[model samples]
Target: MDLELKGKVAIVTGASQGIGKAAALRLAAEGARVVIAARGRELLDRVAQEIRAAGGSVAAVPADVSRAEDCARLVAEAVKAFGRLDILVNNAGTSATGAFESVTDELWQADFELKLFAAIRLARLALPHMNRQGGGRIVNITNIGAKQPRAKSMPTTVTRAAGLAFTKALSKEFAPQQILVNSICIGSVRAGQHEAKAAKAGVALEQYYANLAKDIPLGRVGRAEEVANAIAFLASGAASFITGSSINLDGGASAVL
Candidate 1:
């Protein structure tokens, strides 16, 4: 299906790798001018080069989304590069889980900063631009833990829950403006963090991923490209009527949904 994304301008956060990278590539492939942001300058440039090499319009800006200024700068740079912003993919975050008592205030703050505040700041900055254009899309990347909170999943779940609420409320408030908002409730997908964890545990990467897939009803983990395809749809004109909803990308692993 044609997403009708050609000539659109998009900003994707944490876009140096994983789902973010996939989203960037997919959007660029659909003929959107993509501005990719991440804290790692080297990786960010590499992604930009990959996009450019494929003849996709792109710009890379190294940014740490946890900082308010960085979030502001990312949006600004995107607009400056592309002349407008039509889609904002809030995908910059990390998983932080621990026993309730073992979790520190610092850790909580850090998680909120990286996950919650980053999305909040980016949305706040991007909404005005969307409103002026009369419509836009905001696709937030969250995990299934947000809906089915498990024991020992502290700060991450809490913030994701907030993200769901934020998506719903923002969608309602912006529906009139055609600025749709939604989220992807992702389960385990192949990613760098998982690879690192497997290496740290002295387990073969394939075995580690197999263990994760066992719990999923599909008997396999998801792929970053799958998530990105959904994100690209959500950010496209084809998804004009989809708003204030969360799609489960968990391969039937999430029981709450």
Candidate 2:
């Protein structure tokens, strides 16, 4: 079924690779004019080129979302390029994991800056435009750890929990304006980070991924495209009634309800 997203404009952060790249491609494929953002120019350009090659409308913008100025610039550039912003996907973040004692205040601050504050800043910038347009969608790519924290999960878990709260609060505040907000809580997905970890462990990428899936109920890790599909759905008219909800795209890996 069509998502009825044609002509809509979307800004996807951290679109250089992983779930962000997949979400950008999915949005473009659904006929949304997409502005893809990341800190790396080369990979961002490559993703944009790939989308263009597939006849998808996409533009690459390099920005570090942790910076307030960069967040404002990203939204401005998207409006300048596409004339309006209908979707904002806050997917740019780092997985800073460590024991509580090992995580420094700097690490905690950095995690909140990128994962929480970026989304907060972008939403603050985009909400008025969305209100003016009569409606819009914001999808925050958080993780299942936000809902179910394990041992040794520091800054990431704390910051992601904040993100979950942010998602809910925004959903409530904007519903009156028809601005829907939600989150996709992720689990283990096959992405660039996993590849790096595999290489670091001196194991084949496939083996590393297999090890990751052993504990998941599905017997395998999820694909980036799988997460992207959920992102697109939340940003589409198809999810008109889905505000204030956190959908766990973890293939049943999350133990909490």
lDDT tens digits by residue: candidate 1, 101-220:
999999999999999899999999999999999899999999999999999999899999999999999999999999999999999999987988899899999999999999999999
Q: What is the TM-score of each candidate against the true structure?
A: 0.99, 0.98
Let me know the TM-score candidate 2 reaches against the reference structure: 0.98
Q: Model 2: clashing residue pairs?
A: none
Give lDDT per model, in order. Answer: 0.94, 0.94
Give the lDDT of residue 81 in candidate 1. Answer: 88
Q: Tell me the tens digit of each residue's lDDT in model 2 across 177-256.
A: 99999999999999988888888889999999889898899999999999999999999989999999999988899998
Q: What lDDT score goes with residue 224 in model 2?
A: 95
Residue runs of model 2 more than 4 Å from their true location after superposition: none
Q: What is the Cα-based TM-score of model 1?
A: 0.99
Residue 61 displacement (Å), model 2:
0.7
